[model samples]
Structures are given as C-alpha cells and as structure tokens.
Target: MKILLIKAARLKSSASRRHDGVMPPLGFLYLSAALKKAGYTDITLLHLALEGMGREGLERELERLKPDVVGISAMTSEAVSMHMAAACAKNGRNPLVVAGGAHPTAYVSDCLEDPNIDAVVRNEGEITFPELLAAYGRKAGFEGIKGVSYRSGGRRTDNPPREFIEDLDTLPLPDWDLAEMGRYKDFVPHSPMLYGRRYMSVFTSRGCPYRCTYCHSIFGKRFRAHSPERVLRELRILKEKYGVSNVEISDDVFNLDRARAAAVMNGVISGGLNLNIFFGNGLRAELLDEELIELFSRAGVKYVCAAIETASLRLREKIKKNADLEKLRAAVKLLVRRRIFVNGFVMMGFPDETVKEMLVTARYLWSLPIHSFLLFFCRGYAGAEMCGTLPPARRIDPKTDNTCFVPGGGCSSQPAWKLLAVKQLTTAVFYFLNPARIFRIFRDLPFRDARLFWFLFRTMSVKFFSPARR
Candidate 1:
C-alpha cells in the first residue's frame, strides 16, 4: 500500500515562510522510519512550507501521488491549514485522512469534528501510527486500537490511552533520506549561529518532568532518553552519510539527566567529530554545573538558551517554573566565560500578572550576562492548565487570539493596546540598557552572508513587531 505524509504549513499565505525556516519536520521523518520498518516501503513525504506550495499545488500533488492513506502532521497554529490540506487531498480519492501532532493530541475532538479528517492520533505516533496503518490495511475494526479517536456510527469513539514507549533505543533512526535534505539545508532555522553549515536536528530524549504551565501538550511529564551508544551511532550516520557539520539538539531538557548528557557529550568529543552543536530549545538553568559546562565547551557547543520564563520570583513560583535565579545567573556567567553564546527565553502577560511584575523580569534580565533574549506574550494553548480559565471565544482559535494584542483573551487584565505598549517598552528597556548586546549580535552573526543575515533580520522583525491579531 502507498502512504503519503504531509507537514502542513502553519499559516495560509507566504507569510508563514518567515516563521518556518528550513527546519525539517522531524516528527514525520520518524513516522516514515516506523512505516518502513513495518514492511511498508512505498512511502512519500511532502513538506508544503518548504516546497512553497499553496492549496492548488497541494491538490495537484495529491492527485498525482494518489496514495491509499494520507497523514497530516500539524501544530495548533496550523489548524486551518490542516483542514484545507485534508480537503484537497481527499477531493477525488477516498484515502483515509488522519491528523496527528500537538494540536490533535490536545484537541482530538476538534479534529474529528472536521468532515475532512477521518481520525486523530493522540500522543506519540511511532508505535500508534504503524498499528493504525496495519489495522487499516487488514480492514480490521479499529475499536480496540489504542491512542486513536474517530467517528463511529455518527458518534465519536475514543479508545483507551496508549502507554508511552519506555525503550527509546529500539526505535529506528529518522528516515532523512525520504525528505529533500538539500532544500532544507539552505533554509535552516537559527542559521546565524550555525555558520552556514548543513545542520540536522536530533532528539536524544522525550518528555519533561517539569510542570511549566505553557508546555503540557506535546510531551507529558515522563522523562525518557535514548542510551548514549544509540545517540553516538545516529551522530555518526549524520556525519558520515549526510555530511552534517552542525547538529541542533531538540530535546526539551538536554541536561535533565546529568550522567546521560555527559556521556553523550563525552562520546561526541572522544569520537573526534568536531561538529558544531546548539541547544536552541531552552534548557533548565538550575541543572547546569561546572562539569557539564566544561563538557559542552569541549564538545564544540556554540549556542545555548535558558528558559527563564519570568524574573519575578513570586510569578515564577506561581507558574511552577521553580528556576533558581542564583543558579541561572551562574550558569549564564559560565557559558559567557567559555565564549559560548547565551540567550534567555522570557515571557510576559500571565494571568493576573501586572505590568510592574513583568517589568521586574526585564530588569532581572538586564542584570544578567546573557548576550540576547527573546520576549514572548504568554499563549494559553489548548491542553495547558491555564486554558481551563479562558472563555469559549478565546479558546476557539488560539493561533491568532493568544497574543498581547488580543484584549482580555491572552490572560492580561490590561487593554490590548496597553499590553502591546508594555511589551514594546520592556523590549526597549532590555536592549537599551545593554548597547554591547547589539554589537555582540553583529559580531556573532554571519554578516558576510548577506542572504542569511537578511533572512534572520526579516524573521526576527516579523516575530517582534507582528502581533497575531485577528
């Protein structure tokens, strides 16, 4: 049987390209590997955003491929796009249309409500997706299939929850060969620090034990990681076969397991693979120590980001961040001393949080040794604990309504204009207090590559200035 997997574009127009760079869809790649391992060799992958395809182009491709099954991977922000793609793919053919990803995992009923979608896959798809395909191939009843929600006899039926995969070592390496790797290399996200080398993203672990209110959708609290040996083998494959000189570790918490993290770093160092490594996903600052810092520096880690959501201790505790300010400061200092670039990930507009409290975070950031920072308005995405407090209208489409520009919907007591002004003020203060940070950006960025520099500048500007206002 032929299978087609599509990574839906996040937004409707070309504007989505500004946000989604050459970041390959790692989730679909893993699913492809699982399908291949299950003896389903006829599989095709399509990334709409990377291919610059619109609805018409999508329909053209769907008609040409004519797969028996089409799976769409999407995030919460891509709900509309997913529906459009599904409708187009099922225009003339009767292929089974399935939706999976963070959005579907959190809002399965929302996906099943759409006429274009036949089923929604919840949680991890590596094991569940293969089982689902096999059941479809055999024409067997899906009543007993775990981790799936579908419409049955005009009623929605959700099966029992599936258990998480504990042994991550058994999973096959991601099928990068199925994707157009050359096209992705030119448009990789976070290219400034990458030094214009071919880069690939790898996940050595899944799940985070922390209770950060904003991050409860995709991966739950259970912490699972691949063994160091397995991680080394994948790295070797990337280096030898793909000629990947840079790797972006996409783990939620890279240093959660100190011993395992150290083992992976030591393995990279001992293997003589002088690859540039980056942790663009924020890591816990409190988990870092001198030993880990040294290991990272020795392993050629050039970029690190810490998730310091808020600087206000009261707000931090209220949100269950549990990050120690002292430890975070020390960690930033260590990375800076080692010449590793550091960035702080911060947020504003929490429920019942005042402008004063938000400014306190900006002030704290000003006092740190971090080279730069990203300020974001809190988004009460579905499946988050805070989403329970939101009104029905606000919860309808969080992609556009969960920003500072949305009045009273993003959990801010202030008016939309006021909240936006405060956000602008906080960003101005953070950068104004540190002129050296501007010079640092120039020094670190690859200014020689005008194309890359412009791309980074345009993306950053859009994110900073454009509020997701409906």
Candidate 2:
C-alpha cells in the first residue's frame, strides 16, 4: 500500500515559528521506520512546517503522490492543522486518514467525529500502526485492532487500549533519511541553543513512573527504556551516518533510572562519541546526586533542564508533583560547580492557590543556583487527574483545552489576566532585581549559545517595557 505520513505543523503562520520550533518530527521518522520494517516499500514522510507547506502546497503534493493512506500526527497545539491536513487528504482522494499523537490519543472521539479522519491510532503506534495496515490490507475492519478508534456506521468504536512495548531496543532506529535533516539543522525545538551547527534530538527512553497529574499518559506509567548499549549505537549512527555533532537527549524522564542513566553516560564517554548533549526534556531533580552530575558532565552534558513544577510545597501536593526541594537545590549547586548550565520549569495559578504562594514560588525559583528558568501558568487537560476532580463549572473544555491552554488562572482565586501579568512580572522581578543574574546567564553559556542570551533579553525586555501585560 502507498502510505503518506505527515507531521502536521502547529502555527498561526509559517512566519511565527517561535511556538513550534523546527523539530524534525521524530515520531513520524519512527513511524516510517516501523512501516519499512513491516515490509512496506512505498512510504513517504512529509513535514509541513519544515517544508513551509500550506493547503496549496499540500494539494499539489496530494495530486502528485496520490497516496492510498495518509497518517497525520499532531500535538494538542496542532489540532487546527491536524484536522486541516486531514481535510486536505480527503479532498478528491479516497485515502484513509488516520490521526495519532498526543491530541488524538487523549481525544479519540473528537478525531473520529471528523469526517476527514477515518480512524485514530492511539498512543504508541510503532507496532499497532503496522498491524493496522496488515488488517486493512486483508480487507478486514478496524474492530479487532487494539488501540484503534474508528468510525462505523455513524458511531465511533474505540477498541481496548494496546499494551505498552516491553523491549524498546527491538524497534529500529528512526528513518532519518525520510526527514529533511538539513532544514532541521538550522532550528531546534528543544535546546535551541547548542554548540555545533549539525544537531538533532534523541529519545533514549519512554514512559514515566511518576503520576504527575498534568502529564500525558500516552507512554503509560510503566518505564521502558533502550538499553545503554542500544543508546550508544544510536548515537554512533548520528555521529557517523548523519554527522550530528550536538545532540539533545529529549526523553521525558531520562534520569528516572539512576543506574541506567549513569550507564548510558558512561557508554557515551567510552564510545568516544564526544557529542555535546543537553537534557532538553526536564529531568526529575530529586533523583540527581553529586556522582550523577559528574558523570553527566564527563559525558559531555553541557546543559540541564529540571522539572520543578512548583516551589510551594502546598501546590506540589495539590498537583501530586512530589520532589525534595533540598535535594533539588543541591543538584543545581552541583551542576553549577560542574560548569553545566541549568534551567528550571516552574508553574503557577493552580486551583485555589493563593497569590502569596505564587510569589513564594517565584522568589524560590529566582534564588535557585541556576542560569535561567521558565515560569508557566498552570493549566489542566481532559485526561489529567486534576481536571477530572474539578467541579462541573471548572471542568476542562475538551474542544479548546489541553496542557498548553491559555492562562485562565485555572479555577484559582485570581483573574487570568492578573495571574498572567504576575507571571510575566515574576520573570521581570527575577532578572531586573538581580542585575547580576543577567551577567551570570551570559557567563554560564556552556555551548556559548548566544541565542540563549538573546532569548532571555527579549523576554525580560517585553515583560519590563511592554505597556500591555501578558
């Protein structure tokens, strides 16, 4: 079967790429590899953002390729483009359009409701997607396929959830040949600031054991990871086959298994990959120690982004984001001592949270021994435990809501606008009050990524000088 997989872009316009940076669509690459392994020879991968393709461009491609099946993956932010691309595929073509990725997995009914989308391959698609093709090839319906939700006679049938993949190493490496790696070399979705020109992202693991209420359950709570040996092999390919010098380890919980994490680092050093690495996905701060920090540095880890959701202990409990604040502090100190740049993720405006708690969180984040940090206004999604517990009035708007919802203060005591203003000013307070941090941020550039400095400056300036508050 002729199959076309598209990494649907989430953007207001191609010109404004700040929200969705030029990520290489690692998910689609893996899907392509999976299809190839299933003995599918006629497969094509399209990345709309990287190609600067809109409806017109897509129309031309659809006419030219005339694919039998079109699969589109989209995050919550990319819902608009996801449906749009599906509609494009349906126009004048009898191709089956399948939707996958974070948005579809969480909102299966909505995806299948659309006439453009024939089905949804929920959660992990590496195995299920190929099996789906096999069943379809035999002219069998999707009724028996686990993890598939499809439309049947005006009703949606969602099959039982698929079991998680046990051995990650069995899956082949992503099909980098299918992607426009040259375009991705110019912009990075994670770790925008890097050391070298040729850079890429690598996922060493899947799933998280922690049940952070605000996180997606796509990977499930069971932690599955590529063995350290398998990880080293992937790195060697990036270095040898693709000439990728700088790498972003973008695992959701990379350091979840401390011993395994260390083994991966040790292998990187012994393998002589010499790749400058950054922990773009936030690591659990409490898990790190002096020894692990040293190993990370030795493995060429120049930057770390820790996920410290809230500094307020009360808020942390409310959100179920358990962490040892003291241990996190020590980890930051150790990373700093190792000359590794550090960034943190902090959230504000949880349900029933007081303004004082936000100020405390901001002050704690500012006082941290790190170069930079990101302050987010907390929002919940349809599948998150927090939202499920909220009262009817406070329930998530499934059509318009996801983790990246617009800051509505989220059932908090304060107004959304006030909370946003405070959030922006909280950042201003961190930099403007401590003039030394500006210099420290510049000095702490491990990759000498000037883009980092410029990003900080632009944000601080807008918060301080912009008349309209965020």
Candidate 3:
C-alpha cells in the first residue's frame, strides 16, 4: 500500500534559520529511510514549507497524494495545527490517519479520538509503524500491534510501549534523498556568534540522563547514544554530500558518558571530518571540566550550551537541575579563555516559583559571560515527570483549543503573546543595556537579517519600559 507523510506547518514566531534559510524535516527523513529499508518505497514526503505553503496548501497536496495511510509528526505546541491537518486528511474519508511525535506520544487517548486522528503511535514508530502499515494493507486486525493506540468499541486500546533501538548503527542514515536538501542548504538560527554562516542540526543520541522537571520525559531517564562510528558516518555524509559546514549535535546531554563524549570528539577529529559543530543540547554545565572543555574545543565544537535554568539555588534544586553555579562559572570561564562561545539555556517559574525568584533568575542570566541566551517558559505535558507537579485540569484539557494557556500560570499571563512579557522585557533590557557593545559585536552581520533582530529587540523594549498604572 502507498504511504504518505505530511509535515505540518509550525508556528513561525521567531525566524532563527541555522542552515542557510530553511531547515529540512529530519524526523520525517529518518522515518522515510526506515520505511524504504523495510521495502516500502511507494512513499511521498511533502514539506509544507516548500512553495511558501501553509496548512490549506498542505491540504491541497494531501488530496493530490491520496495515499492509503497518512502519518503526521507533531510537537506539544503544534498539537492544534496537527489535529487540523489530520482532520483535513481524514475528511470523512478512510486514509487511516496516524499521529506520532512528542505530543501524541504523551496524549495518546486525546490524539486517538480527537475526530481528526484515527490512531496514535505512543513510542518509536520507525519499526512499529512499518509493521502496522503492513497489517493494515493486508486487512488484518491491529490488536496485536505493540506500540499503537486505536479507538475500539468506544474505548481506546493502547498497545505496550516499544523498546528503544539499541544498535543505531544498523539503521540507514535519514533519507535526505527524498527531501529537497537545497531548501535547507544554508539555514542558520539567529545567534550572536557565527551570524553569517549556515548551520544544521543532528542527533547523535536519544534520551536524557538527568530528569529535569520541566522537560518532557517521554523518552525516559535512560540515555542511549549511537556509536562513535555511526555518528561520524552521518556527520561525514552531511558535510561531504550536503555541503553542510556547521553541525549542531541536538542530543539531550552529550556528556552523559564522558568517555563517549571523548570518543565522539576524537572520532570527528581523527576521521578528518573537520566540520564546525555545536553541542546545542549536548552538555549541561555540571558535567564538564577543564579537560573536557579542552577536548571539545580541539574537536571543532563551536559553542557549548549549558542548562542554566535558574540562578536561584533553591529554584534550581526544586527543578532538580543539578547545576552548581561555581562549577558552571569555572566551565564558562575555561571556555571563554579558550575563545569558545558558551550559550546558556534558562527557564523561569516552576510550580512553586515566586516573582522574586524569577527576577533573581533574570538578573543572574544577564550576569553570565556567555555567548547567547535562550529563555523558555515551563511546559507541563502529560506523562512527563514534571506533569505530576501541575494541577489536574491543565494537564489534559478537553477543550481542543489551539492556544496553550494555563490560568494565572507562567504561560497564561502571556497567552496573547507567545513569550512572557517579562522575559521579553528582560531580554531587551539585557541586550539594549549594552547597545554600543552589541552593535559593535553584530556589526558584521548582514542587514537583511536585521528584521528579526530588531523585531525581537522592539518586542522586549515595548514590554520593558511601560509603567504600572495605579
């Protein structure tokens, strides 16, 4: 049977292009390769971003492909749009719509009978989905499928979760051949450093070792990584074949195993794959030392991003961040001395957080001598370790709304705004507070990308200086 994959349009609040201008849907590429290796080649992959397409344009493409099965990958924030896409695909027709990814995996029942999605895959579908589709094509009862959820007799059947793939070396590299790699040729995210060059993201590992409360822990607490050879092979392919110069290793924590980190770094260095790499989600601050920092620097790692979720020691302990400020400072200093840029990721407002604590975090974030900052609000998805701390209604709202808001919560106050007004204010305050220095730093950046830079700057400015009326 013919299978089609539909990539839903994601919200474009921030235009941070890392590789040239557009980023390819690598998740779909992985699945496409798996299906092809399983002997399913009658597949068509459609990226909504192509042709300047939106959701409706995707619907038109769906009608054009008209496959026997349709699969959509969704994130927590894009649930509403994904459901809409699934609804349009189903359209009262029987194309066997299926949903997967972080959102559907956590909210299986919600995604299953949402009137738009026919079924949901709870865990890794790379292997499970091929079997499910084979059974569907043969008109077999799907009760035996292991990792799928389906509506049956007014109740949902959630199959047991599948095991993680242990040997990633066996799997083929993602099927970039099916995608228009040229579209993603040079997209680069907005950043203070390396502003002109293009960079793309790759995953050398899956899962996280530490259980950060706010992170969606659907992947479980065990860290799994691809072999050094496996990682080097993919990196070489990305650099040699795709003209990719910069790579971002998007793992949950790259230094979970110090030895493995060294091996990967050494492999890249010895393999002669001299590509600029960024440990985007690699190492938390607590894991690195001077030796590791030196190794990473020698391995062509452009930037090291540490999870500096908060500066309040109590708040950091509350989230189980496990980051020690003193050690974090030392690591940052070492990287700074080595001329390597260090980026910090900070989050605000735990369930028990206070305004004062948030201010402390804001102040501490500005104090850090890092290359850049990425601030995010806490998200509580169902099945996450953090979800237990949140109130019940906010966990799974039956109201099928697109906008994610919790009344009086950290995110709700800024419902109309994508980011917290205070966070925006803080970012502006931090950046503008050093205007001449920032202008001097980014003076070499092209003027074409200034629109996004200025928009974010203005967004923060408007929210920062407004007075409180009594």
Candidate 4:
C-alpha cells in the first residue's frame, strides 16, 4: 500500500520559525517506524514546513505519489493547514484522509466536522494505526479500531480509547533511516542555546503525572518510561549510527521517575556516549537534588529549562502547577554552578491572574540563577483544562485576526493591552537589570544563527507595524 504521512505546516501564519525549526517530525517518524515493523514497506514521509511546500506543492505530491492513504499530523494552530492538505489529498484521488495529533485527538468531533477528513487516530497510533490499516486492506470498515474516531455511514463514530503503551522499550527507536535522516542535519529548534552539531530529539518517556491546566494532555497523566538500558541504547544508536552529537530529551517531565533518571544518567556516564544532551521541553526542577545535578553534568547535559509557570502561590494552586518555587530556585543555582546553561519557562496570563501575580513571577525569576527566560502569554489551546475559562477566541480581534494590539478583550480577566504591557515591562526589566545575563548572550552570540535573529526581528516588526495594526 502506498502510504503518505504529512507533517502539516502553518504556512500562512506568523508561526515563529525559530521556535518551530526543521525538526524531524518525531511523531510521524515513529508512526512510519511502526508501519515498517508491521510489514508495510511502501511509506513516504513529507514534512510540509521542512520542505517549504504550500497547497500547490502538496497537490503536486498527491498527484505524483498517488497514495492509497494520506495521514496528516497537526497541532491546533495547524488545523487549517491540515484541512487544506486533506482537501488536496481528496482532490485527485479517493484515498483515505486521516488526521491525527494533539488537535484531532483532543477535539475529535470538531476535527471530523470537515468533510475531507475520514478519520482521526486519537492518542498514540503505533498499534492502532497499523490495526486500522490492516482492517482497511482487508476491506473491513474502521468500526472496531480502538483509539479511532471515524465517519461511519456519513456519521461520526468513536471507538473505545486505546490503553497507553506500557512497555516503551518495545517500540522501535525512531527510524531515522526511514525518515531520510541526512536531510535534517544541524536542524534543531531555533533556540540560540540549542544550536549544535547533528541534532535529534529523543523521548525517553511518555505521560505527565502533573496536570498543568494549560497543557494539552494528549499523553495521559501517568508517568511511563523506557528502561535505563533502553534509554542508553537509543542514545548509542544516535551517537554511533547517525553521528548525532546534540540531542533533546523532549519528555514532558524527564525526571519524574528519579530512579529511572538516575539509572539513565549512570548508564550514559558508564557507557562513555558523551552525547551533548539538553532538556528544552523542561524538567521537574523541584525533583532534582545535588546528586541528580552532578549526574546531569556527567551525562553531558548542556542546557536545561526549569519550568516555573508562576511564582504566586495562589495562582499556582489555581492552575494545578504544584511546583515548589523555593526548590526550583535552588535547582537553577545548581545547574548554573555546574556550568550548564539554564533557562526559565514562565507564563503571564491565566483565568484570574492579576498584574500583581505577574510581577511576583517576574521578580521571582530575578532571584533565580537562570541565564535566560521565555515568557509566553498563556493561550487557551483546546483540550487544556484552562481553555474553557480563558478562551483565546474571545481575545482575538476579527478586524486584525490576531491576539494582537488587542484593545479591550484578552484571555484572562485582565485586558490584552495590560498583559502586553506587563510582559514587555518585565522582560525589559529582567534583561536590563542583569548585566551578567547580557554578557552571557553576547559571549555566545557569535555562535548563534544570524539569520534566525534577523528573521525573528522581521516577523515581530511586521506584526507590530502591519496596516492592520495601524
């Protein structure tokens, strides 16, 4: 069977290129690997953003490949692109159009509302996707396929949810070979700190136990991890087989299992891998201690992002982020002391968040030893617990079609302009007051991508001065 898996792109959006760099669509890659393992040989992976393809380019590929099935992976922001790609897929042929990813899994009925999409594979697709394919090949309908929502006789039907995969060790290491590994050379996400040689991302675990209200909990709230041996083996494959030097352990919270974390670190240390590791997604900083920090250094961890979503205790409880802020500060100090670059991940807006709370977070960040920080306005992405209370839709102005120079509306009780003011003021203050941090950025500035810096500037400048804003 000719199977085409497309990584949907937000081609028309002002999506940050620096943030969404040319990452090997790890989810699609895993699915391809699963398909291959299930004895399906005819699989092609197309990354729309990485390939710089628009609707026309996608149409051309659908024509050329003549695929039997077209699978599109998308986030909420890429929903429009997914539909556009699905329309293109259905244009030339009667191939099955399937949508899967955070958006579809979370809002299955809404995703199926589009006539073009035939089905959505909810949650993990490693097993269920192959089962769906086998059923399709056998000319049987997709009725009993667990973890799937499909159009049945012109009506939407959802099957029982599939159980989360327990033994992560059994899943194949992402088939970089099948993914055309060479094409993604030196392409990590567009963080200046993330620039390194031959980068790839690894997920040593699945699931997050903590219910961060703003998170899209596609992976269930249970901590599941590959064994220590399995973790080291995947790294070894990347290091020796693919020559991957820098890697991001892109788990939601990698150190949730302290023993597993310790064993993996010990294995990396004993194995002599020397792979430059980073935890860009973040780590549960409060979980770390002196030993864990030392183990991280020995394991070649170069960068870590301590996720301190808020500083106000009241706000933290409201959002279900139960992080110990005091411990987080100590963790940041330890990371910095070990010469590991640390960045703080913080959010500004919430349902009842006050300017006072926002300032509390800003000031708390000043007390940490983090070399840098990312302050994002909280978005009400579908599937998050925070979505209903703080709907981003109400915040956007149709005239500008942006959460932009928002006049009166905002996601939180606070106005959009107020949140913007707080973010800008705190950001400016954070940097201006910290001469040491400024020096760190410049010292490493020469090694960073100049194009990325300029592109970011251009994107922001255009957004601020566009005729819509004026």
Task: Answer with 2 or 3, whichever has the higher TM-score.
Answer: 2
Estimate the overall C-alpha local distance difference test score of candidate 1.
0.78
TM-scores of the candidates in the order shown: 0.93, 0.94, 0.85, 0.91
Question: What digit string (tens of lDDT, one per residue) describes model 1 on residues 207-283?
Answer: 99988776664766888999999999999999999988788888888789899999999999999988888888837
lDDT of 3 by residue, 107-136 (tens): 786687686677787767788888888888
Query: Which lDDT values do the candidates have, in the order given?
Result: 0.78, 0.79, 0.68, 0.77
Please give the distance, in angstroms, between residue 127's alpha carbon in candidate 4 and its true position after superposition. Answer: 0.6
**Backbone clash numbers for all candidates listed:** 1, 0, 14, 0
Per-residue error for 400 in candidate 1, Å, reads 4.7
Q: What's the CA error at residue 84 for candidate 4, in Å? A: 0.6
Model 3 misplacement above 4 A? 11-22, 49-52, 185-199, 392-425, 434-470
Candidate 3 clash total? 14
Candidates 1 and 4 compared by lDDT, better number: 1
Model 2 segments beyond 4 Å from truth? Answer: 11-15, 391-406, 409-413, 449-453, 462-470
